[model samples]
Target: MSLLEIEDLRVTFATEAGPVEAVRGVSFSLSRERLGIVGESGSGKTMTGRSVLRLIRAPGRIEARRMSFDGIDLARIPEREMRALRGRRIAMVMQDPKYSLNPVMRVGRQLTEGLRLRDGMSARAARAKALEALEAVQIRDPERVLEAYPHELSGGMGQRVMIAMMLIPEPDLLIADEPTSALDVTVQAEVLRILDGLVRERGMGLMFISHDLNLVSRFCDRVLVMYRGRIVEEIEANRLSQAQHPYTRGLLNCLPTIGGPRQPLPTLTRDAAWLE
Candidate 1:
């Protein structure tokens, strides 16, 4: 069964120029597997992920025929009820940890805040859980990390802490929006390994939003190619090279291969018909 489902999801913003649709009529379902959404900036990949959690606010609005998670209707749920589900059931890791983590707060306080406030965990127990979560992500010095502030850690360490924070709740579905975009190749691989192991062991669904086609093809089970706010094609990750859509083909062709060519990478040609 699907852990999350969406049909005709639309995200719009009120602009002086009129209404701008950031995510237009996109739909998909996710089981307990890694599903990747790949697209260039402005293709609505991040918007779609945020819409599932009802994170859009103010000038932005979300509308959908159906959006549900674990048999619960996300669209119809009260904000109070949604708040209860946010971390405990569905968690999201933002692209940058510097902005996401409170700069003034210690890592331990941030990690244990949700548990103590929402789950009513004792301070001692929450600290222990936080340490375990850090260890799971391969942070060798968990105690030092818990005491340090966000700025005290490196990009890779901060990202790992974000993952650990989300995993502490043992959420059923995790939406990671460019979680490793800022990390170096070595750290990126380590983060992916940690995420893969956690998802497999816990049987949690993952919506991995990224623009790296090569990485998505290798890491995810299924791939959704988005173009101009719509899914242009869906294909098995292993067979992405054989995708039938011209947009998907164009994207694959644009990837720069090592030792393949010395010339500049080819530019992606856009087609208006692909938006239809």
Candidate 2:
């Protein structure tokens, strides 16, 4: 059975103009594999990830014909049960760690809090686990990092620390929403490497949300190209070069070629028919 199954998922927000459909009739299934959701901003990739965890607030509502994680029916589950599932069974690594981490709290305390509360571990044990998780993400000087405040860390270090905190609970699935977007190219590679290694070793399902088509194609097993709040194309990562959808092709063509002739990046031309 699939680790996650979402069918006819729709997210809507109440606006002065009318109800805006942010995610429209999306359907997909994932197992213990990487599934990439890629699109331009406001295409609803992030909303889709948030909806999986029931993170949508008032004035915004999620409706779906079916949504399940493992054998649990997420659509029908109680909030209490869903809370237990979150962070313990399914965790999300947000796009920006600066916003995710608490400025006043020390990094080690934040990491240990979840372990102690969720796993019923002693403070000493939780700290040990926190340090181990830091090392697992290839963070050098885990002890030093643990003691530092979130504001003291660089963008890359902050991101790694976020990843470490999320992984400390040993979740079955991870929703990484552009986890490397705020980092340098080199740091991006390092973060991806750590995520790739963890997914492989742990056999965890990953819902990787990103705008970078090339990165998704390289890192994911399957790709879903969303446009205007709907999935316009679904392609195997290995077959991304042969994507048939115009939106997917347009995105791919926009990527600059290294050491190639200089040219203006292609602008994406939208078709109204795609919304239907």
lDDT (10s digit) by residue, model 1, range 46-74: 99999988999979999999998999999
* TM-score to native of every candidate shown: 0.98, 0.98
For candidate 1, the C-alpha RMSD (Å) to the true structure equals 1.0
| Global CA lDDT computed for model 2 | 0.94
Report lDDT per candidate.
0.94, 0.94
RMSD of each candidate relative to the true structure: 1.0, 1.0
User: Which pairs clash in the backbone of model 1?
Assistant: none
Candidate 1 deviant stretches above 4 angstroms? none
Candidate 2's C-alpha runs over 4 A off are none
What's the TM for model 1? 0.98
State the number of backbone clashes in model 2: 0
